[model samples]
Target chain A: MEEVRNQQVILKDYVNGLPKESDMLLKTSSTILLKLPKGSNGVLVKNLYLSCDPYLCCLMSKSQVSHLESFTPGSPIAGLGVAKVVDSGHSNFKKGDLVWGWTGWEEYTIITAPDALFKIQHTDVPLSYYIGILGVHGMTAYYGFHEICAPKKGEYVFVSAASGAVGQLVGQFAKLTGCYVVGTAGTNKKVELLKNKFGFDEAFNYKDEQDIDEALKRYFPEGIDIYFENVGGKMLDAVLLNMKTNGRISVCGMISQYNLNEEEGVRNLSHIIMKRLHMKGFIVGDHFNLYPKYMEMVIPLIKEEKICYIEDIGEGLESAPAALLGLFSGKNVGKQVVVVAHE
Target chain B: MEEVRNQQVILKDYVNGLPKESDMLLKTSSTILLKLPKGSNGVLVKNLYLSCDPYLCCLMSKSQVSHLESFTPGSPIAGLGVAKVVDSGHSNFKKGDLVWGWTGWEEYTIITAPDALFKIQHTDVPLSYYIGILGVHGMTAYYGFHEICAPKKGEYVFVSAASGAVGQLVGQFAKLTGCYVVGTAGTNKKVELLKNKFGFDEAFNYKDEQDIDEALKRYFPEGIDIYFENVGGKMLDAVLLNMKTNGRISVCGMISQYNLNEEEGVRNLSHIIMKRLHMKGFIVGDHFNLYPKYMEMVIPLIKEEKICYIEDIGEGLESAPAALLGLFSGKNVGKQVVVVAHE
Candidate 1:
């Protein structure tokens, strides 16, 4: 068996509050073999591109997410990534077949349960898109907005974290659905990008606003029909007040509260009952059954220029920790992707 | 036109905190008319039993509820009451018809919007029952639990403010639906009433417990499948953390937060995304169209003795304000109703 050098990003311990670069360490694994054991039904993959998602921070915390296990100390952190099969004993995959799903932060991984990876069929688009617009982020925006909100033409939609990977797509989807879409971001530059690049009708820098409730009222004079909740805490409290009667709030991520040790209180939730609001939360992991259907729709949109995707690319596995931690502080402008090895 | 000595419960001004007896004044109308004018479509009714609902406190605040208008300070407080039509120019009701709907908190009221009244179709049950189990409270429990939650058999359910007008019934409905239900109340007596009388599988006195989250875990170790929310604030925050995956929270009322100048912050709402929870809020006013369906189901259950309704009765019109305000302090054991004039 031919062995190769493997470098891995290892979690030193469970993270508390906001993550720092020191929480992760780069380590070289001396005992990793290039081939799977005989009779092992695993696919050995060379990880090409690794996704830096905000949710990994949650997995790194002491709390357990419903569908995912907490990352163990001294182990390589696992997340979604684009990889090519180098060796396989699994029937569904073979050598050189491109696949993307849960993989390690190392240069190579043996995905013991090979079915977790999706075999990439549409490679005409960028292969890295499989970790983003064609993968988790795309499925999240598609299902969380359309399936949850059920928008009608001219309905008002307000997306928080509007310039992020998922929010950008949701805003574009809202525009395409003939809805009046507004977005909120952390900086004026991102706000401009939202209105100009993503086609949002109006966009605002949430940091510049003194009162988010008044800011929302100024934009949605008739009140918001759909709220794509991304940054929770005060933003959610403000959104609760500005939501129209019978409005829908699709809970995707609470980026604001995730890093906080003492999470901020959302005080105005009583408005939910007062306005008969529908607030539903979902995890993208529970919804991969629709990935094929999602690919069918988003692929054409990407080809026809009907949808736009932006990525903040990091160079190597060394840049992965900073890229992932940057999501908490709003450091990355788009989908954060790290190139571990270029094909 | 006939004149009667009408004593009305007048709200002195909009209450800032918990309502007291002095916030309302017993006023005798100087200029009163008991009959409708020529070509007027009003119905003059002699009010019987007045419903003391917790939602009236929301109207008393500066905040606005979607379906119902705020209570005016100088005017007589209005609410759902059982009444007998003494004079009618409306086509739906004639003289001597017993009706239940929105009426002034007085011995007599001119119901300008007569269609708000529902003519008593089933009087085999008590007339006061119309304001409790047969009217708004009944509808609130039925639709909020059944339609919104869509609970399955053997699911674990939890209800807060479990001995109140609506919550008591929700516990019974859960038991009937083949679900295990646990209820939380302020007093041990009410907790006993919930388990012994209402057939809740388990009940606890919230005041006796130090940590609500721990109490919920003790009662619902498997995690709650459905939560019928009545008392909001800290209880809601605790429930959010304890909710099972794909669970539902039906926001019926927030009695604990209503009287506070600043509502408590719900800090654990991010658990919604962690558990993929579905939370919906509703007002009973919008679902009156289902009155026939509700009455068909509830009236038979009442007649068959399959359902039990408990009421904390107040003596007169003078006792109306105290009874309604008592809801905030958990002074009432069950549905608080005032006997303005017995049939």
Candidate 2:
């Protein structure tokens, strides 16, 4: 086995506020053997599609208290990536197997915990879909909406950051469930994408609205039954006021508050009691067991044109840093992915 | 039957911020007919015990959005009360039948909504107990703890306002479920009552602790699994930080915030997502169907002396204003009830 140059994206240092592109460095000095060592219980993989997730920004932070393992300043930043197994010692994954799991931001990686790697059963669809639409992001939207929010038919649903990787899917899922769905995004383009392309009943650019509460009251006159909360802070405060009795809030992410030095205080939390609301928070990794069921339900829809997924792909590993940081700035139009090596 | 003077507690005006005793005027001008008019559907009752609940303060405000009807100035204040049927046109009640329901804070009155009146089968317990231990306060504690919190054996349970009407019962119920319970109160006496009388595993005086989060850390090193949220300002914020993964919070009341001109902003609600917490707000009034089942479960425990309820009785209707306002100041030692008349 020969050592190959592994071009990687590395965290320059732990980020403070909104992550700058310089916070991540692209390095080519890293090299890895394209073979698993003898008797080593690992799978050596050539990374293909690397997912640019908002949660990766949380990992770039200095906070050690978070459930996600923080990225070391000098280490290669890691995230969910689709890969082709080059060599393997693990029984589940063999050589030439298409898999996706916790892989690095480099061309090649030897996954020490092969348990994290899942074999791709159907390659009938695009393999890169495993990184976004068919991966943790997809599963997150599925479990977070169907399980956490528990949307009923004809219910009023609201999604924040509506055109992002997860939010776009949540809005569509709400529509598929026969719910009256409304979404909020930073830019008019994303808002337009939400209403026009994603089949949302209504969409609003929150930046245009002077008062978020008044905007929500205007859009949701009857009040919101379910809130898919991706961007928390003032938006969450507004949603709390607008929620109807027995409303459910699925706390998928708080991207708006994550970069702030001090998280904004939510003033209308007592409305949860008055309205008899249920607010739950969940992690997709914890609900991975639902993956097979998720695919079974989602694939038929995708194949039949009953559902759609939009991907915004960066060409190479060099673009990974900017693409990943772009999430906080609302730069990516749809599901953000960086294409590394083509199979 | 003849017209009689009804000594009543009337709202001088809608209260602002912390209610002063002067906000409620003791009026003797009110008069009512003791006889039920022919073809009338109402029931006339002699008020025995009037409940001074924390929720009444919310009614004193001018917020029409609240589920509770605001107290109209110059009109008699109304709340949950134990009464004796003097004259009845409603079939559910007859002369001398003891009943309890929504009644005016007065000597005698006509209950327009006779359906709201519940017949008291068990005079075996103290009649005043109907206004405290066996009424909405009891049911709030029961449903809030057993249904919402869904306590599993050996789970860590924390209750704020631990010696108050609802919180004390929640702590006791947690103990019955084999949970390790900790409670927080405003005073050392109340704390002692929680630990010793209520059989909580531990108790703390929140007033004594400068840092509530650190105090909770001291009490629950492994972190809280169930938090019965009664006072929902700073205590709720602190509890959010201390909650374990998949923690459940039953938001029964936010006494601390009800009187504030601008309710305190909860800063750590985002922790709900990071910790995968489930926070639900509920009203016992919505769960009235569970009352009979609750009575069956709780009556036996009360009869066997397995559970205890403490009542802080104000002498008469004149003390009602002070007793109700005392809840916010943490002046009432236990369940605050005003005894208006004797059997």
Candidate 3:
């Protein structure tokens, strides 16, 4: 085999408000090889597909995320990616095996934390599914609903950002559990995707609604039992008014308030006390132990055509910046993935 | 006993904003005596000390509180109270037994739900202790801190309304756990009580601080790990900015927002995501089963003088309206309890 080298996309500097292409630089270094050194429990892999998630925006920012170290300037920006094993010094992975995990936004990656990567077993389905449905987002939707909310059958479920990666799956999971699921999306296209594709009980374009509380009232006349909280601020306040007694809210993300200097205040949080509600915020990484269980449940659903997943694929390493930034603008229809290299 | 009677303090009308004395009226009517009927597993008691909790504000408002039935106009307002059983059909209690639970703010009450009431096991402690430390508020502090916050030794705990009934207990609990406990009270008197009587590591007057965030930083150089949230609105927003990563907020009450027509907005909640914090709201009633466990833990603390409790006792049943109104004005020193009867 030819002498191996690593190609990496590095963060030029910490971004301010929004990231630009110039904020990241692509470079190829010939100093190192792909093979894992002796005594090193690492996996050297060829990155196939890289996942672009909203949380990456915070990583790109100068501010450090709590519990997670900020990405160092002039280092490769890391995220979830599907990779093929080139060489492995880890007992869990072998050569030519497909895996997915915290791969750099580049053609190849040498991951020291092989434990973070999951070996791809169900290659019968599209391998790309590992980046979205069967990966972090899938486990997120599963745990956030089943574990956090502990939803009962016939309960009302409301999902914000409902057509996005995690939100779509949450809506579907709610439906499978015999819940009346309604979702809010930013656009008509996404609204249609939520109702038609994800099989939500009802979907509404939040942008079109004059009053969010009114829109919530229209959709949830009886009231919301389980709110899959993806967007916070006013949406959360609106949901508070529409929540049933003993309502449960699983705080997945708050995309709307992430970029702003200040987030909107929720005026109706007092409802939590009166209504006896439970609202909890969680990160998927904290619930990583559930990944294997997530795979077991999701793989069958995907194989039997019981679950449908949509991905907006951006081709090549050049499109990575736009793909990552598209999340803020709601440009991507479903899960946004950038293909760094082909098999 | 003379002819059976039901004497009640009925809410005359739905309160528009701050409740007025005219909004409630006391009426005495002969219906059923304060005696449990045959085969009825209930307790008939004369309420001695009734608590004036902030949550009662929500019930007084026309707006709906989910999972809980709102007090209808012309019906007696109910709250946590210390009572003396006149007669009992429930096997749990005998005549002259001191009890505490859901009881009307009146001379006599017929409790159909005998299971809700807890028989006062230790009368050596003040009977009024049942209205604060040994009652729902105390259990709320217990579960909200130990269970919800899951506080560790040496963690930094912040209690809002620290001189108040529940807040004082929470601060004490945090101190018992080896935490650096800081609290905010409205006045100098309350602040002194928080620091001296409640054994808080630090105490601040929220009204005196020009910048709440700055005050928080000044008091807690290291960020707060656990926030026993009682006052919401701006205090909550300020706390959001000063929270440690993975901090826990146990929302017991939101007194600041309770009286407002349009509740104040919290602009820093997005920090929840960045901090990976956990914020949960709970009712003490939901955790009532922990009463025995609470008593087991707290009774000793009180007897050993390891813990101290304070009460703002209103003189008579006639003073109940002013005592209830005093809560909104921050006039009560500690747990606001009305002494309806002495003998």
Candidate 4:
């Protein structure tokens, strides 16, 4: 049995308002045997990449949103990450096998539910890609845009928070579906990437706009047919008014409302009824059944270079806190992934 | 051709905020011909059972909700009503044919789109039902509940504004589907009627509750599986928190939002993501293709006395404005119908 020091990022306390870097602190675990105990169902793995996602804001709270448990204050925050199995008491997993799913924001973890992990079979692509285009974010955009939105060819599409992990994909997916796509981002730098890099038909810096409703009217003169709602509150209200009749809103997450004591009130919801819109919210956990089908479709596009996936890599486990906090302020350029170890 | 004085309820001016009775005034035309011209495609109808519905609030506003034309200030306000065809140039209809659909809030109207009318075939039941359980409200409730919610037996269902036209039918429809149902109305009197008359498992006066979220917890201890959202604003905000995973919200109308300059901001729409909820808003107009099928199912229920429908009827056209304004205040306990003529 081998013992080693495990570097981890622990939640200092339940977060209030926007999470500050001080609310999380780095800790190194005392040496422990890396080998799984006898008859254990857990897999001991070395975590490589950790994903910084907006939904993480929900679990950092003590309020206990129905389906999620709040993060334990002293424990390592668990999130979607890429890991290599060190030893396993789970029969389906073996030493040296690569897997991607929920893992600790640390160097190593004992995952009790190995069944929840998806095996990383395609080494042809970057291993870190598992937490980027091939992981939870990938599954979220695929299902939220393709399944929930059900976009049709030539339909007008709008993506809010357009340069983030999920919104970027949704915008691209809309284009792949032959839809006219426009996107909105908090900064003009991200707005530029949405149009020039992500292939969005039009992109705007929402912060620069005097009135979002007026901006939306200009962008979508005929009205938006599908709105991939990554931001909520006033953005949602204005978008509601701009949606075409029978438009769809695939609510991936409301990054804007996550930190507030009182989430902003979306006042234009009546426009939903007036426009006969379909707004559906989804969690990626519920739709893992489609992951295999998703990889089958998306992997080919990735290999052929037909899909343009962007990455914003944070250097190490120490960067985890700032990396996660950056998502709140639109500091990251694209998919934010924290690399704990290269191998 | 014979002519007669035709009385109308004209919009005094485009209404703002909650519509006041003064916003509409009675007017009489010098004369209206009792016969259609030989080449005209319109059907001359004598309005009988005129419906006063909440959606009319949208058309009354100067801000035109897409898909609806704002009511002309001096024109007779139009709504769904039961009428007798006095003369018809359209081949599908004839003189003395009883029909129900869009008609002016007046004693006489020439419906240019007679194709929109649903011909009244069954006269055994109350003719005014054409505006209640058999008309737009009925179609709204049926499609919104069965088609949109897509409920299964044993699902926990919640209806807001539960004593109104659409909510009442939805509550009854849930019972017919063998689901557990609860409803919220503005008054205890309406609440009792919901439980005793409409067979709801539980009913509460939302106005009486100090905290609607707490009230929802009491009613739906396990959480609501289907939400027939007839009221938006704070009620919708609270209901969002109490919905079950994969819950369905059939957004029939948002009566609370219709009158507000800035409609109440619903802060808890994130519950849509937490519960993976499906929230859809629809217009009854888009779904009339199912009208024939709806009539087949509902007429038998009426005859068998298996379904309960309550109507609040105003004796004459003079009462139309008050009847409509009552909706904003929850003044009507059931479907509100204004009768212009009985023969």
Give chain A TM for each model in order. Answer: 0.97, 0.97, 0.94, 0.97
Model 1 agreement with the true structure over A88-118: per-residue lDDT tens digits: 9999999999999999999999999998889
Give the TM-score of each candidate: 0.98, 0.98, 0.87, 0.97
lDDT of 2 by residue, B21-119 (tens): 888899978788889888888998999999888888888888734678898998888999999999988888899999988999999988888998889
Q: Can you write out model 3's per-residue Cα lDDT over B193-246, one digit (the tens) per residue? A: 998888998998989999999999998888999999999999999998999878
Worst 10 residues of 4 chain A by lDDT: A61-70
- Candidate 1 residues B15-59, lDDT tens each? 777777898999976456878888889898999999998778767
How good is the docking of model 1, by CAPRI class? medium
Q: Which DockQ-derived CAPRI band holds candidate 2? A: medium
Lowest summed lDDT window (length 10), candidate 3 chain A: A61-70
Rank order (by DockQ, best first): 4, 1, 2, 3
TM-score of model 3's chain A:
0.94
lDDT string for model 2 (A1-343, tens) is 6988999888899988777888888998988888888999899999999998877887888883468889999988999999999998988888999999999988999899999888998889999889877888889899999998888999999999889888889988999999999999998988888888999999999999999999999999999999999988899999999999999999988888886787788888889888999999988889988998999999998899777788889999999988988887888999899999888
Poorly placed runs, candidate 3 (over 4 Å): A1-13, A20-45, A64-76, A85-97, A108-116, A119-121, B1-12, B20-47, B64-78, B85-99, B103-121
Model 1: DockQ vs. true structure: 0.79
Model 3 achieves a DockQ score of 0.50
Better of 1 and 4 by lDDT: 1
